[model samples]
Structure formats: structure tokens, C-alpha cells
Target: MYQGIYGSSKKHESDLDHVINRAFKSGVEKIINTAGTHQETIQALELCSKYENLYTTCGYHPTRCNELNESNEDEILKQMIDLCEKNAEKIVAIGEFGLDYERTQFCGIDQQKRYFEFQLKHLISLKKPLFLHNRASSQDLYDILYKYRDEIKAGGVIHSFDGTLDEALQFIQLGYFIGLNGCSMKIQNNLDVIKQIPLNKILVETDAPWCGIKQSHASYSHMNTQFTSELVKKEKWIAGKMVKDRNEPCTIIQICEVIHSIRDKKESFDELCETIYLNTKHLFFSDQ
Candidate 1:
């Protein structure tokens, strides 16, 4: 996902399969590769289907909404929906969709809203959870998601959440789950926000190669581990390897550790990890 816009140039193959295996070896039961465009969703689903432990979400990210031009918008959308309909068994969620005010240069706010609502309206028929995104647009995202709350009865996840406690509470109130990554632990206030989240309402992710925890963070020592030799050799591998500070799925354990350290003392460490893991499974792989 660290690739350039569209990720169309990413031609590496069978690489993610290795990553999936490594994640499983490291005690990760399942992983979801979210899509931001037609090619990405297709590629993600295809890759996910190869591993029982892997799943993918299908939808347009707000920044990439413009990838569908006005002339071919309807047709392209139908194509995406048809793809989803044809492969609903492999697709776990409807997004990586929502407002992103931070990227107004990539797509106008109005355009983002248009496609976001469109996806939300159609997500009802897909009968899957949502993989939501919101960067400096929680109010708008919440307003829109609220309108489709009934349709999104399967619940949703606010992935890579770095929002305020109030934003987290609002989403939790709606029965949505929060996805935290190392990035969320970057700021003191963000760590404080995490402390307020209930164990059962939270999930952890690496947002790999992007949201890896800072080495300077106190929890790194206990949570950090060397990347597997097999993973370290693969150029297109997931998570950080020994060479550099890339985010890897295995690092999720670190996110868990960091969270566990700062979280409310409502649950023991084991209980907290189990609860978050089950929350993720129930939300994304309930059908399984």
C-alpha cells in the first residue's frame, strides 16, 4: 500500500502469500487488505482468496473517488458492484471509504462526499461491515454513516483511528469498532485517547509501512522483534523487516502491547488481546 497513487504499478506476485503465512505463524489469525480502487480491490481479493487466513475489503477511498470519471462513473461503479456481487464470499467489508479533508488536493470534498454516500447506500445490499476512514472529517463522516446506520447493521471499523476521544466515543456509541495502529500511539494525547477506549470496542492494525510505532516509544523494547528471515528476503513483504522501519503485520502485537499498557484497567492483558481479536473476527469474518 506504500506504492504510489493507484498502486497499479505494483506487479510483485505471490509475495503477499508469504506475508500471510508469516502473520499466521506469528499468531495472527486473519488479515484484511483494504482496496481503494477497482484494480486494488480485485488484486486484494484475488490475493486474499489464496489464503484462508486472509480477507479483503472492496470500496473507493475518498481520495481516489475521482478515479471514476463522470463519463464512466455509473458504468465503473456498476462494474465494482458486480464484482462485489460475484465475489461477495471473498469480500469482507465495503470500505476504506469516508471523508478525508486532509487530501482535498487529491479529490474535492464534494466529490469525496458524493462517492462516499454512494458507497454507503449500496453497502446495505452487500451485507458486510465497513472499513471506514476519516482524517479531519469525523463530523461529516459520522453524519453520513449515521444516515446509513440501519443498512450497515453488520457494524464497521474506524481503521487507523487517530481521532479525539469524543470521536471515538461517538463511533462506539454507534456500535462501531475502532482500529488502532502504532501511529495512534505516536502522540501523548492519542495515547490518552486510547486509554479511554473499551477493550471490546477496539482492534489493532499496522497500517503497515505507514503507521509503524516509533522506536523511541517506551514499549518498543518489549514489543519489538526481528523480522523473519523468509520475510526479510522478500522485497514486497508486509511489515517492517530487519533492514528498515516498515510496518509489518507481526508488529500488531506491539500495538497490542502498547495499547494494553496504556488502556483502561478494565481487563487483563490476555483478556484485552482476546477481546480485540474476537472483535475483529466478528466484524470482518463473522460469516466464517
Candidate 2:
């Protein structure tokens, strides 16, 4: 099992440590983190190195590409590249890299695109799997991905998935696996998406410190005919549940619980464990 911190929104310090330790106790032997910045990467590496199971994924997040200051862009990129090369054995992937139009606090599309392409080329050369991020930029992202689909034949997931069934089908066609997280359980539409997704193509994540599933307080919010109502409710629940609890990696068990509830099989745990384990290995360990 994978068991390291996620480099998304900042998780509570104690919670982060709790998740890592709990996962370690539960027999998780590896984890892929998205250290979206250089400092964050270094800190996580320092904290998690004691555990032989922990690993890191370093890159700028789609929404945080603006954090890549113009003056420091080249230097930061070089540092990231060097870190990846130096710790190639420890850093398994190069991402949380993609496009996010949902939040414009970051740079414009062009800048995001530039860094994304740069990282793609870098990882392709390294022949590593990606820990991707894409939200509200699926079409454009898909278009760009298709161009390099063959050249960057090593595939990755669109993390914290929020795309349509058709869009997901397109990704599968391109040899990408879909990442299902707590959002999958809290969001009913994603629940529909989850049911339809092939067992072999699904992987689970918490995206913790964010995207927590709020099953307890959100079970009965009324909704309009449009799915938008439910989507909003779900997003709120995911955020509230995760953050309210300090959002840690060990919450992966909560993620599994939600998945089990949706699939409605008492045996979901065993099946899910086996399928997700195999799926993760198939994607990340194919070359191994």
C-alpha cells in the first residue's frame, strides 16, 4: 500500500504525521506525494525519509503554477529536475502537474501549459508515471495529452476526478487510469461515474487536507433537477469533512469505506483491495 503525504493544500502538521504513521502501521509500504513546490518537497522528504515506505512526487500544481515566479522559474525548474534525477530511486513520479481553470488565482493558461509541457517532456524522458491534476481544463488537457500520448506513453491519472463519463472514456482510451478519491463517495454524480468505471481502471486516493468525503452531515441536502445542486453539495461535503477532521493520509480507510458504501458490497474491501493493488502495480510497476 502507498503511504505518504499529498502535496496538495497544506494539511495540519499533526494530522499529516498521524496519517503517515497510521498508514505505516496498516502495512502501507509506498506512497506518492505531490510536492507542488520546492520547499514543500524538501520538508516532506525530510519528515518522511525515516519510513522506508514513503516516496515523493515533485512538480508545480496546476493552480499554483503562478507560484513559479518569472525570475525564479528557470532555477526552480532546474532544482526540480535535479531533485528528480538525484532521487530517481525515491521519487517515483513527476507531478500533480496539469491544468486547472477552476481557480484563476494562478497564472494564465499559457503559463500552466508551458510548465505542464516541460514536465511532461521531462517525465517522458525519465519514463515515469505522473501524478496529474486537471480541473475544468479537461478538453484542452485531453487535446494536449493526445498529442503526446504515444511519445509520453507512460500514463498517469487525472487526480480527484470530476470529469464526465464520456471524458473518462476518452482518457481510458488514451491508456490513462482514473483516480477515485473521497470526492467519489461524497459526490453522487461521481458515484455514478464510479459504478460505471471498470474495476481494473480505478485507483483510490484521499487527496487529504482537502477533498474529504462528508457522509455524516451531508446525507439529506435537497437538490434541484439539475445535477449541479448535488455537485455543489458534494463539493462542500468533501471539503468540510476532510478539513474538519484535519485530513490525513490514513483517511484512506475512510475513502475505502465510502467506496464500499457506494458499491454496496460487504466484500467491497477485499475486492477493492485486490483490484486497486493490482491496478496501481500495473500502472506504476509495468516497467519494473
**Top-lDDT candidate index:** 1
Question: Candidate 2 lDDT, tens digit per residue, 1-288?
Answer: 112223553332323455566556656656776688777778667765776767777787877787776698778878887877887766777787899887756678888887788767655777778788888888888988887888876678878887888988888888888987755555567677767777678887867666655544231132111222223221133321223333456556655555565666546577877888888887766655
Alpha-carbon lDDT, every model = 0.77, 0.68
| Model 1 Cα lDDT, one tens digit per residue, 1-288 | 334222455423434444456578889877778788888988987777677767778889999988867798788778878988888777788888988998899999999999999878966777788899999999999998888777777899998898999999999998899998876777677887888888889988888756766668544543535444634433444443332454667667878877777754466878888898788878887766
After TM-score superposition, the amount by which residue 73's alpha carbon in candidate 2 deviates from its true location, in angstroms, is: 3.7
Model 1 clash pairs are 209-247, 239-247, 239-248, 240-246, 240-247, 240-248
Which residue ranges in model 2 land beyond 4 Å of their true spot?
Answer: 1-16, 69-72, 216-244, 264-268, 285-288
State the lDDT at 104 in candidate 2. Answer: 59
In candidate 2, residue 146 scores what lDDT? 87
Evaluated at residue 58, the lDDT of candidate 2 is: 79
